[model samples]
Target: MTGPETDNESPETDDEPPEHRRYARYLELLESVQEADEAGLVAAVLRDDCVAMAESAVNRHLERRAAQLLTDAHFPDWARTTAAVIGDRAFLSRRLREWTLLRAIALDEPWTAEEVTGASDWFQRTAAAAQAVSSPEALDLLAEHGRTRRVRNAATLRLRPPRRRPG
Candidate 1:
């Protein structure tokens, strides 16, 4: 049974390209599917024409968006790795500036962070090895911040601080 055709009720098939770019290709492919004379194709179930194509594209876009959201929700692994590699102080500073996760982190950030941490670990291990080779001498430089000390030089032999009990 058919009546005067309307826009919404246009033949389950129409030559107009789908309204969007992504599904335009799918629509074209489906049109070819419709044209096939093989009974198998005709019977292959089109998902009810336009509705199927639109729904498929929406589902695809939603799936991709969900994956991106999930990755963002659990991005701390990269931050911790970054903290470990860049060294605690620099990592803290950079984190204060902006988290790598806050930026577009798809291609380069993760790889660069791994490399940084690897190099940092290597440097630490190397330093420990070198320190094991010989004991290094260190000097202690201390000053009494509140107390003033009289200078004892070749030109002046007098001292000003009391060496005995203050009581």
Candidate 2:
């Protein structure tokens, strides 16, 4: 007995495809992240899935903000890279192939600000962890991590070596 569907009808109904439903959920989560205070932001990012979704979401502003939040929280380089790779899909795809190189040098788990500071080679450790991932989404995550690591390392190499201390 329902009349024609109106433009204002909620998109959350069973009529929507699974992808649309997931996207709607992502949008909701993005709003929650945007509304969160610093502590809440930290908590949200602690969930690996949340951070992973934040990286690949279509909203550039959300992606960049998520990256900034991770950086502010002192997350490892891979985490930072995850958020940094939002704009270029082809670039992200290519980076996935080189993920194995990161195996020895990255951190494989989500960390708090306190935990991240003590880790060495977070990129390599994260990459190593990523080796087990088989899905395209997981590959995207690994690719972002590798890309960030390479950029950070390159930047470091570009810096002049420290001058020798005066005798």
Candidate 3:
């Protein structure tokens, strides 16, 4: 049965660009998901719509807002710890660094202590690599390192069992 259309239920018109559509969707999600628990908010961020919005965001304000939302969202201790490690890396662009760290936290499941340590070690190595390079190359190297570290961590987390709480 058809229900009355609400403001958010309206579909995008044919003329709207995909980026604009995604941005609108992200805004809607952001409003509705604000009160969601950490896991729920992380799940929202990981949705295909949100990921597309994040990747295609051309407006600096919007991008920064989205990163702030992810950072403010409740995350597990391990994810927060890993994010702190990533945040401390030198020679990385603050925007890219924070976004990448938030993305890692969003993707994180129940993580082991060893896995968290591995992420910290990876960021440390990446920071060292950045330090070894020229200024311009350092930023590029750090960005590359961030991407590589996130990919490796995602793979590792996928293979490891989810952490169990003490009964």
Worst window of 10 by summed lDDT in candidate 2? 1-10
Q: How do the residues 2-106 of candidate 2 rate in per-residue lDDT, one tens digit apiece?
A: 111211236556686444444455455555653324333333333334434433443433334433443243444434454344324443333331232222123
For all predicted structures, in order, the TM-scores are: 0.19, 0.24, 0.28
Candidate 3 Cα outliers beyond 4 Å, as residue runs = 1-12, 38-42, 49-52, 56-167
The clash tally of candidate 3 reads: 0
lDDT of the structure predicted as candidate 3: 0.40
The sequence of per-residue lDDT tens digits that candidate 3 reaches over residues 57-108 is 3223334444454435443352443344334434223434434443443444
Note the Cα lDDT for every prediction shown. Answer: 0.30, 0.37, 0.40
Better of 1 and 2 by lDDT: 2
lDDT of 1 by residue, 26-110 (tens): 3344345321232232222223355454445433432333234323644455344324433434433343223332222322233
Candidate 2: stretches off by over 4 Å: 1-12, 34-167
- How does residue 132 of candidate 2 score in lDDT? 37
* Ranking of all candidate structures by their lDDT, best first: 3, 2, 1
